[model samples]
Target: MTACLLPASTTLASVPIRFVEPGEDGSLEGLGDTECAYLEATGFKPTAGRIALLPDESGKLSRVLFGLGPSGATDRNGLLPGKLADLLPAGTYRFENDPDDGALAVLSFALGRYRFDAYKAGRADGQGKDGGDDVRLIVPDWIDAEDVERIAAGISLARDLINTPSNDMGPAELEAAARQLAERHGAAVAVTEGDDLLEAGFPMIHAVGRASHRAPRLIDITWGDPSALKLTLVGKGVCFDTGGLDIKPAAGMLMMKKDMGGAACVLGLASMVMAAKLPVRLRVLVPAVENAVGGNAFRPGDILRSRKGVTVEIGNTDAEGRLVLADALALADEEHPDLLIDMATLTGAARVALGPDLAAFFSRDEALAVEISRQSHAVQDPVWQLPLWQPYEKMLESKAADINNAGSGPFAGAITAGLFLARFVEKSTSWAHFDAYCWNRSSAPGRPEGGEAQAIRALYALIRNRYAA
Candidate 1:
């Protein structure tokens, strides 16, 4: 199921999809007595997510009816209608009463069709047990089909990368994927891997990743004009986190494969920016590694020096994401890029605070924060701004090192993690840090239960308006 956003030239006889709310079926035009009676007899209340197929005189498939539930309940998730891509029978469909935001609904429908069947032993496109042909959505003239396809494709790439198991997606494989994306966009990519990271002054990244057999690496991609506004993106690319010497319980380790979700999301955003040929110079830095446990693993008490020359005490081995991001963010800060952003699955505290559906981000720049907040609302990609509490910096203080990677107290874990990162960044004019839980525990609307792309959509919109304007 590739893009369902077919061109307007698709001449197939399209089916009309009518959205019906509670007690609103009477408003549906051209509904004959038979159809009304059928609905009444069926007790169709038009509750949310309900779908009913109507047949015409000869019992041929006619219009499709999707429910809107009770009033005020329909538009909860802007992309709720995207579920139709997976639920509806394979055919061409168009909405007749789509009173909601048309663009998001349409885009969601396009994104909803994605299914990661790569690991499936013998599945081909449109060849699953319940699938025969593609379910195509007619592109509304008002909607930009190409842009919808572009965004969907980027999100799909991130989902794909994040969904892949660690056994198949180590540091080397992650580098290859980044390289491939760079090559496609004619961007220049440079990689510093293994012991070379030490030689290149990225000690924290090397320290966190050295225990794994697959060598650690920093995948860097640079694109666009030299003199344009410089934008740098840093992502934590821990392929898998074993929690190192302070090993995690089995339950905690179950979803460790998604440790690189931040990298996947940035690459997804990069794909969108590069594909659109945005005007600004863009740089992507991903410190790829696996925090594995072995005799060579950096111990909990170890103090590792960062690329920025700050010594960090390893308070907790599980807090390695911030370490890798620190070195990468430090490198990005050196150029004093106009904008620098780093994202990671850095803390479970963020999830505890905002839940899995919402991501937490920190930004000291008020104007930029306001702009990002606006775009996030405009796009329905929810992200909450958590304060980078200055006072919490003390939580990361260490006697043996400049700062500790993890906090001493249970409070403000997310804020302290942000503060830990802020220590390495100073030159950047505007910077933000995101702590994202890049997986959905349960399927909802356009989001499936597997790996997800968080915050990038809103960030993409912000960048487009800010730089490309």
Candidate 2:
């Protein structure tokens, strides 16, 4: 993890950071005549995310001006100050004005400071030499510094796991990460590994991962009070997806290491829930595997029995994410949790429909869908709801099995995948499925280009609101 939030200090030379709204240059009052004239001469018209450095009379760095766009305009990016973390020079800084949402500003600032330097040279301490930018923010009095740190920690955990390569992050390594998380939170963890999955009734999980040298395992972590509201989260942990017998092209296999992004995301969310001590009994299930091609690899046209007793015909071995998730979701559903949610970097169709910035989620429960949608906008996590559409259920029909792993046609690929997973989940459970790209195609203000954490924040907010302690 990178050193993001810094402690407040009284003696350090602090620069005042001011946010200016468009057409509101008057807000720069009390900055002294010389500084104001310098800003005006430089044509600093308060454009959104634009920054201007101001110097003092002695030619020393003084204050900084950041544009917040317009007053009535909605900032879908949430915190505007996050961009400043990378732009500001190595020094301590303080906010000049009190923003409407102080916590988000500080949280975003910490998020923007993140850098994945794990494999980079000179990172003996995990953070590289450039890590010592020494950029610090004096958090506003109204904002809880602890809360900001907690959220940033969760986000960093997900980013770190996703950014790691497949060589160092196989199924065994993923289980290790979960164990470390469980240890920190005083949670109990049980792992069902290798051939043991067969006896454990996770045949689909076993079949999907039988080819890999690294054994397949289901990571289950439980935390919080036993009597509290039951909240279960399932994540697809395909550590590397070679597409099994149906191998992907060289271009398509580049980002296969991030196939386990869903597991990383759920673990991150679980960390936040446990850290916040949310009044809920949280259960996290990750079906960790590597869909590699070998002699023992399951082939296309093979029939497999799921934990839910539903037989599935393999339409395509490449569509293995849902296979592993199906078993885990069935296990979670058996307990009939109050809320069951599964997230995966499942389909390219989802990316084509909603793009990389937005996540596509599906749910049969209308009220739960509305709440998640509302919270997504509130947190700026950006999720859109797609219907379960029972009519599309026929798309997954098979002559030999109860269902097919993929749809019969290219149309509605993401929807069909959602419907396939829905078969494992009990009808009475309030379940939601997130089909997220989990990778940013390009770098944005607070969001870096590599493995991004989507929907977790919004889902966390929803859980906190529903089970406020």
Candidate 3:
């Protein structure tokens, strides 16, 4: 694998160094004569991610210097390291006078080093074609290297799932992904499918996915001790949304294959938790289905009974992500787990309010919300908080049923959707819902312009700290 991560032990000696900024006045506080001359010899000016090779007195090639942009670590820094991965002559190097957080720093380098070659036949034109040695990062040696590798691997797993097209990643494919992960971790998995969904009390999940040839299924994977703090994660796994009878335009359907991004995300988070061996009893519920336009497809305005025993009137067949989630969330709620989190690509409204880069998180608990925010920001996996406005509950009122799947009118769509899902959680004091846009529209350093993982990094941090401590 040409794009694999280089463990942090490689040497990057003789590389020139400079922080990229508007002015060239910042001094290298403590450097030897050789290092200082190399900097001057290279005429290194601060340009974001610009690498210049230094030379020795004997004229031998020396170290390289990379420009750090303004605001230091806070500047749109995701792909800064990635630039080095592609540009640097494959050699090991360590950051000098870096931040105290080794995990974040090391992870950033790994992310910068990420390359998506799955679809690439060969190196593209105008790209740096270095058959150089892998860049080895040098940490302070106090950090848990194994843990860092595990989390990075987990994020990669989520990325791989989301990056895959829907044709190859349907309901059955999702189950296989979960099963493989379970087998690796020594966990147990149970799958309920087809008519068994109705028999098992997941009528809403069954109704939404019944039209597709791929049988609708619910994946239940369990790990950890029975007495540990119980945590349940439910993800909306709409493999592809043809929008059912309501039908979306061809453009709308173009990326519907990424509809299961939420499921992919939670699976990623679950993988991190299990791989790290966090001290929490974890349960993952994914209701995998394809909302197709079959003759047997459930129509608009139909009343469907949910696992929570509440009747929901379908206002828009296109708003099908929340239906599968409702059933899965109810099942998760029944256990009254200490913490419940659900992730989905549930609304365009969320993207409209917060944009595609950030996920919108909704929760009734204030402290948990604050902590989640802190953790997300700390890892640069930011999430914006959306209110669960109680008044909007009236918007989902159904004349023929207990509730409507969608809100009245177009305003506050994200909040109203959150309120709808909030109604199903009978228990669980701390719950959070992340309306994520799992797809990226453009490519950046570590993050490619494809299926993306939102908020999982921050949530994973919060979970490990909350339960293990």
Candidate 4:
């Protein structure tokens, strides 16, 4: 989605988009008698999703009346104003009066205009000149224009990546995307691919992706001063998951293209950090792979040695995301980073527990957990903390190997998966794991129905505040 915002410096004779709550239209002083009568005659009430286009005596567009619903309306989405992007005819418009949340107002307006039009091709990569490009929003001085644009661009990149089909976004293509992002920020990246992963002690990563023609690889990205505090992010990049030997049913495989949502979202957050020039040493590790079934595919019941020297018994080949994340998390933990965070679409149980909007997170540090919750609510980027339930750790015990890749029971599936990854994260100062569902089930306000970047906004806010110079 292009940032559909005019530069804050724009001084053009633009039309004002006035906001009105229920029964507040009479207080609007700018409207003349004819316009007031027109509003009453038309029965235009400021209810949610309603917009009024007011024309002047010359019959030209002059103003807009946007609805805000009741003051404490339960379902009043903060991004509700985003509807204006599509509702209004192509023209330059400005919010005459600042809304209660100006930041969210502007951000939603830009994102509301998002469209995954790369393959369809009105705007390549959802950027450049759009058919709706003329629908420009005037950026007010109270909101940071550059910050909002950076965020919108980052999120749009993630959506574009996740929306792409696996045929065009396999392991190698994912690496190319990572490299492109690194190049843009002048960051350095290294990749260990194919059998080299076995030599590099990333056996689990190698085993999961060995069957695919697009050889699996680990992509590492680093930026900022070496002496600065280290923040490491590890993402499970299973570009397409067919569930390997225990292949998913036809219905289950429908949206497997977004199995690498963790990678896309981490890169989105990384983009924001680089663009804003945040003060910290950043490292992103993505185990890019495709979990496919073939003659060479790793089978259930196979025991694999991981980078951390822990052995895992594969009880289910479908549980492949955590296998790749294990090796990368172990490598990340080796540096004992100030903060270590790993994101993955590791379990459906997470989605069942928190639904699609709230990201389910597990953290070892109490303070970090509290701060993340606080930041999440403050920014309206919701996340709910799920405990690192110690008792559930026993469910992953393996008589064949040191641990089992899949838990013995279905109960506490999300918690047990976090337990599996936790075995390799012994050295990091603080660690958190997020199980996110990166696709939206339906369109609403600023959030569209396709691939969505979850929890990164809240994570960015926490990182920015915690590591500020």
Candidate 5:
């Protein structure tokens, strides 16, 4: 269930949350002089993540002070207020002054309150440790409370899906989740499962997923008016990649449940778009599968035909994400939508190059890349653009087939993978691929050490601005 962030009453009666910068004491301006002096004498210093409580004349709690690190810090994680959400006692709070980014502060607060106790005992009642806390944020006059709630709801949905264990989050479960989202928004859903994939010409999706006892499926959902601008989204939903016949080491397979993060992310974005009722024909395609190591698994050196009719030689069975995505992307491209986006947890190279915080996206369209970058900075959802590098196309050359599933060299693995997927996309279409690490390594202010949602906010901002009616 999604956590409630905004307060029921819009009137400002809650305690004020004052955000202070390092070496700044002016944030306590409205406080009683004695209370300010007491804070100072008690060794209170303005530093990031530091909080101080204020008391009234009768010694009852009055206001809160939170540190915002040094002023002019370039790399501020907007989720700082989220720390307060976790620490503050059950009560309502309101920012004394408008935050640097009101939307981010609201989002961070809601996200920080998230707890995934789905499988834990006593959680069947839908209550967690933080559930009883009546903590809420008074929506700022300038901020749209509904918009923030919508985006936060989407993020929570993605996190819940990504955090679920593989036992309960198989291909079928994923399809059901998609259906639920579509039904909630009055969208249409169509799923092609099992041998139907072969009949539907999604041979590559079938070839990679045939090994698992659970059937593989392609989840396609559509919403909005057909006459509007077309926006197609494709996500790689590798539910649990056991590396197929090649198999991963135990350490490498630990986080395999998050392999479907791409699928979760697209669904989150779709939710936001549909909720906002953007003037665009939206379609989401997710190739949901588990790459297990059963006897029927496709083996290295085997050739398989894709939906686009391009034959691919399997250089490594572990590189199964690109195979399933190939068929899905091909299907998405057939419509030649005005904007096409595909996101996946596709490569370790992306993590090495950009780390886990910043997602690496590839785009052939310079204008779209620029707009996305602009919005990324505005929203603080970071994404770095990598080149398509036409020269690297040779790295995927295969003598046995039209292309190879894995690149020839170890270097530029991310780029080569992008190049391989680029084969399935039409050159005339405006397409962008995001390689994201959907898991957080450690606990941060608003983000906990678990599955996370990335890149959706900036992309939503871009779409909302472009197709604004």
Candidate 6:
């Protein structure tokens, strides 16, 4: 399915078209004579997120009509058209006119081409084949096609990574994925593996990932000149979290494979930045691991030393995401980069507060928080600002160690987790933490269920707005 911002004079070129609406006979004002009669014959009603096809006298589809929920309620219903991309006959179609938000049209249309066909047999219809539809967007002469393509590809990459199951994707797989990205962007790459993690001063990362048969490693990819503004991204790379010694129920472990969603998101964001060739020294740090139970598993109550030289008392073995992230975040902080951002699926408290669709972001810098909120909302990659809440710092204090890996109480779980990470950053560097659910529990018009890149688009937008100039 292709997307285009066109003028009203532009014709449908005989492609099947549908007018979307909220009810029957709603907003018939825009219908042409041929469109009206076709709608009647198809029994088309304007149902939100519903599509009705209009066929011609020769039985060929003429056009598609979609219904808007309500006239002016800030409803972002454009993505609904994406459903038609795979379901309808393959052909070029154009938006009658430019939408108020063109990005939605551009992103959703491109995303509609997504298909999780790794091991599955080919569809008899052959709709989504190699590389999906060769879609084209008809943008205004003023719009930059390169910009649109960069963003669309970034979103598609994230969706593809998220859709792949854990069995097929793990720490080793994530490194391979990162290596591919670095090769494409002409970036430098380095990795510290298994026992090497301890020798390299990433003990926390090693401790958490030691149980898995797949050895854990720290992935580093750098691009651009040393003198350029420095930006570092640390993503939680838990390939699968089985809750270690504090074993979770079978149901809780079902989606543990997607624990690496954070890594996938940053890779997606990095693709956009590098594809756009943003002028900055970019560094991506991911400590890839699988929190599995074994004879040598790090158990609760064990004290571990972090890269930052602080002692971390394990309050809960299940709280392993932050441990791997702590070492990676500490490494990023050592550079004192202009900006540091870490993304993770660290706590269930955040999901209780904002649900799965919105990521909770924490930052000491008010300006950065505001800008992140603005850009994310603008692009529909929703994120909400949560407080660092200095008072929560006390929850992490420990008697034996400098801090507890988990908070003292259940309240403010997300904030406390953020606080635990903050301890590693001695310098008050401009850092933002994204507590995001990288998985979408259910499918939507443009967003499919499975692994997802939450807050990635907004973060990329914010970075471009700030540094890309």
Tell me the tens digit of each residue's lDDT in model 1 across 373-449: 99999999999999988988888889999999999999988999999999998998699999999998988888877
| TM-score of each predicted structure versus truth | 0.95, 0.97, 0.90, 0.97, 0.96, 0.90
Give the residue spans of candidate 4 off by over 4 A. 1-3, 23-27, 121-132
Q: What tens-digit string does per-residue lDDT give for candidate 4 at 143-209?
A: 8888888888888888878988888899998899999999999999999999999999899999999
Q: State which candidate has the highest lDDT.
A: 4
* Per-residue C-alpha lDDT of model 2 across residues 122-231, encoded as one tens digit per residue: 56644212135589788766677877777888888888889888998999999999999999999999999999999999999999999999999999999989999899
Where does model 6 exceed 4 Å of error? 1-32, 41-47, 74-78, 122-131, 134-143
| Candidate models: Cα lDDT each | 0.87, 0.87, 0.81, 0.88, 0.87, 0.78
Name the regions of candidate 3 deviating beyond 4 angstroms: 1-43, 57-61, 71-79, 99-101, 122-140
Model 2 bad stretches (over 4 Å): 7-11, 74-76, 125-133
User: Which should have the higher lDDT, number 1 or number 2?
Assistant: 2
Candidate 1 vs candidate 3, TM-score winner: 1
- Model 1: how far is 361 from its true place, Å? 0.6
Clashing pairs in 2: none
Report the error of model 6 at residue 115, Å.
1.5
Which portions of model 1 show Cα errors greater than 4 Å?
A: 23-26, 123-133
Can you give the lDDT of residue 295 in candidate 3? 88
